[model samples]
Target: MLSIIYYFVFNIFIGDYIKYSCIVPADASFQVYRDNFIFFVKVFYYFRYFLFCFIIVIRLFYVKNKFFRWLIKKICYFA
Candidate 1:
């Protein structure tokens, strides 16, 4: 779907799209940077994979078109 493709593309170029600002507090410790990196990795992992798949499955299940749902189910079974 276009949503999946767009999200994947966004993830691919996110590193370039987002720039690191060099502002820091004087009292901030090194652990803050490590924590931020961990959070970033978690977001990248969950958003690109789990989050969208969950949304799509929920949307498909809620659709009123039985034929379309059946088609997707068949395709997913083989995929």
Candidate 2:
């Protein structure tokens, strides 16, 4: 429920961002930035999952680098 509301608000914000950022009117705006928007949307979704993999890579790196492993354990102590 909360996440749904957040998406609703985020969508409104994105709409306003695209609206004021472009010189074109809302109706023709889609045609104006179609290809560019599609490319960025794809890259955005691609990196969404990439971020998770990047975090796993960080953990993997710590497993091999004993110095960073201890440093994080001491500085980033958590439950």
| Top-TM-score candidate index | 1
Q: Look at candidate 2 and tell me the lDDT of residue 50.
A: 68
Q: Which ten residues in a row have the lowest lDDT in candidate 1?
A: 17-26
Off by over 4 Å in 1: 1-18, 21-46
Worst 10 residues of 2 by lDDT: 17-26
lDDT of each: 0.65, 0.59
Residue pairs in clash, model 1? none
**TM-score for all predictions?**
0.39, 0.38
Kindly list the per-residue Cα lDDT of model 2 for residues 1-79, writing each as its tens digit.
8546545544555555455555544575576576576455555545535665666657766687788777767755672
